[model samples]
Target: MSSAPSSTVFLASPDADTPAAAQALATIRERVLAATARGTPLDIQGGNTKRWYGQTPAGEPLDMRMYRGIVSYDPAELVITARAGTPLAEIEATLAERGQILPFEPPHFGPGATLGGCIAAGLAGPRRPHVGAPRDFVLGAVIMNGQGQVLHFGGQVMKNVAGYDVSRVLAGALGTLGVLLELSIKVLPCPVAEATLRFALPQAQAIEQLNRWGGQPLPLMGSAWHDGVLHVRLGGAAAAVAAARATLGGEPVDAMEAHAFWQSLREQSHPFFANAPLMGDGQPLWRLSVPPTTPPLAHSDEHLIEWGGAQRWWITPRAAADVRAIAAAAGGHATLFRHGDKLAGVFTPPPAALRAIGERLQHAFDPSRIFNRQRLYR
Candidate 1:
């Protein structure tokens, strides 16, 4: 598993700001205005770990790390707001103190991961099938459009639904829509009890069992099947976990090992991913999202399935078109996740109607097309 250094910096309160942070915000606004005036694009950046993702960035770098700090956090209300540049480690540490979490289990990828980058990437971990995705938890956001105007959408409380859809749209826009400034995200308390079980079943059998169990009430937190074993995690109330554990007969896994194993999967440090760099030349990591009930695709030695079969990861030297064709035939799309010849394409192109809607939104939010231009598409 990949072990990266953890960020030790404790973020300051949202209400308090150092002089340097104020200057950073003002400087960013100025840069946005100038870029809009010149019709030049600005490549919004954070941490730089995920730079390899998406299309090749095309614009002057706009570092967001300078504008950092928590804006507000109310543990009782289960809500936290922080600047886009605030380090994700800091936020997680703060939330852990209150026995709460982001629920979506966003992967850090690297120690320098920032809130803005997390929202821009909009990736969810193993728990996604149980709880929700990143966009679902986003309560609101403050964004700076191409006109250098700051726009606010949604609100802190869950009941505040006005403009909520607009706020959620910024979750995975990759900064193509606008520069994400601050975000208010809903949080959830940590589960009271948790347990991990192991079932030595083949891929097809595992998928069938997962889908069957998915229909009944159970505290299914996360699941993964690779090689010959399927691992399942149960969480929530102690009684519920125990009841489910008794019902689902399987070998038990040590608590510590289970935590580490799940963490490895969330951070993409599992053995499956750790071997990606060594998967031979031209081999790229492909993420396939299909119906949970969809049968397995063509077998590969490096295949790993997660999210109850909804998300599958495979590394192969197959041509991009061939890989996409297989995924499409299975009723889903494919993403060129990592280490590939992206000249062909990183994401499967959206349908015409979806593409048109995206264009209209881009025009409405960034008419100048000066924010991370071509980052999401050509």
Candidate 2:
């Protein structure tokens, strides 16, 4: 375990507090207010790396890359606050310098990926199941609502809350709720030691084995199955990793290869994703998230099972309804992760009650519906 320093560290340079940064923020707020007054929609953009994700962006672009930098860091407290436009790589590198990390392992789809976009997309990597999701790490946020008023939620530290944690709400809201300004996020110590093991097993056997091991006190940090091979990553104290490795027998994977494999899985740069057709091409990539215990769905080639079998990716030309039905039947949902016919919808529709709640939240946060309108729902 890692501990924070007694006092918080102000990571911002003079540049962060300079008039330029302030002016950038003011410019964004003014734009929002002007858009609201004129009844115009604003497409909130950060890096535009994931611009193709979710519904098509509407309204005039509100570029956010200008307002960026780390605001503060508390290593002992394991919290970091930064402007929404701060590059994700910068934050990760900063955390890495101190042997800390965002445990959820967010994916940077492109070099230009930003903190705001990471939260908006809310996509986690292979380590998610062993740790948690993006929402789980969010401590607080500063956002500009439809009225252009900045609203703050949560704080620098974690505590029990009676109602909705608005900070977490913004995690996957796709900026539909408001304009993400700055965010405080919880981080964790990087594993002290790590290793990957390989197993040859069928999908059913792999799922069963992973679930079985999941119930045990193993240092399982990441797991993935593709092309009849299952790779499990063990991380923790050296003794713990060694003990787990000895207990769970599998061929050892080279350290560098293991790192590259997990990175590929995290970035979706693996051959499975590479082989998938582009949006207008023949086939599209689909991500099916079901219970870890759920049996494998009937699917064709070029598929990868990850998160201990809870998150599966497949490349297919299947109908949207058919793919969604399969996931729903398994008590989960399917997302057209990339390169798909989005007119049929990229995400499964929320149930009526959930949809109603979302609608209410949207209305409450952006009555003018001026912020990234229909980015999530549509």
* Inter-residue clash pairs, candidate 2: 3-76, 4-76, 4-77, 5-76
The per-candidate count of clashes, in order, stands at 2, 4
Q: Tell me the TM-score of each prediction against the true structure.
A: 0.94, 0.95
By TM-score, the best candidate is 2
Tens digits of per-residue lDDT, candidate 2, 247-347, equal 99999999999999999988877877776633334467888999999987876656899998899888888889999998999999999877768899988
lDDT of 1 by residue, 173-239 (tens): 8999998989999999899899999999998999999999999999999999989899999999999
In candidate 1, stretches whose alpha carbon ends up further than 4 angstroms from where it belongs are 1-18, 277-282
